[model samples]
Target: MKTLSKKDIKQLNERIGREVFSKKDLLQEECGRYYRNKELVFFTLPQGRLAPSLKFLLKDLYLPKVTVDMGAVKFVVGGADIMRPGVTACDEGVMQGDLVVVVDETHGKPLAVGEALMGSEELLAATSGKVVKNLHYVGDDLWNA
Candidate 1:
């Protein structure tokens, strides 16, 4: 693991729209690092995108989220793309091409991170077919890495 320089941390904070790491936190930090903060949260992505690890979702950070019914939990955590039927709710203002966090309705815990295939309005109006392309999920290589 490579430690992040001050500039990197600053950029990351900007991308995530909040202060993620304090100077103290940065002392032990590194780029492309994933750690368990209750679950697993990636400190950084290869492209420098900051995303909440599924475990981190439990804290309810203010990222765009799509909630799926209990019936979809197994498939979502297993890395299946989010289909329209499974979605129970969508955070308002989600747009196509945006990154979204996928969660289970029962616990509101994240199961995966995905790219929206449709806007929130469109997703809510549809009854079938894919809505979000799953990018990272529990038990995927990134999760294990």
Candidate 2:
């Protein structure tokens, strides 16, 4: 397992407003993805510790490097929500129906894995489409959840 930095962990704790021991310690898995019971889990996963006004968790795993400035944690560990305004960056190679990794710009981490409603650039530049609504946790199969 990739060990997270203590400094980064501290920031995450501050942003989340909760004490964090480790990244793995904060998650629970179901099928193949991991998830947190709380919303905006990214708040507790950033190096800034400051709560991100906007963010997203898109992907099968977390980046633990990508951080954002403002935005809500759109996607959680499990398939949850993915608002348009919260989207920061997307895989340019993704398609409207392809599975893609959504990320929280604030902390630069994958928030959730979901079907793409729009492509990467479109998701970033355009102002329409689902852009990624169907989200599933890295391990929790929302299909079953």
Model 1 scores worst on lDDT over the 10 consecutive residues at 22-31
lDDT, candidate 1, 32-110, per-residue tens: 5544332345546556666666556656556699999999989998889999999999999999988899988987777
Off by over 4 Å in 2: 1-70, 74-79, 138-145
Report, for every candidate in turn, its global Cα lDDT versus the true structure. 0.77, 0.46
> Which tens-of-lDDT digit does each residue in 1-145 have in candidate 2?
2233556566555644556446455443222223354323332222322222123333224322221124545345435556666565565466665545555665555555555676665767766435565344444523233
Show where candidate 1 strays beyond 4 Å: 27-40, 43-48
Candidate 1 lDDT score at position 79: 86
Error of 1 at 100 (Å): 1.4
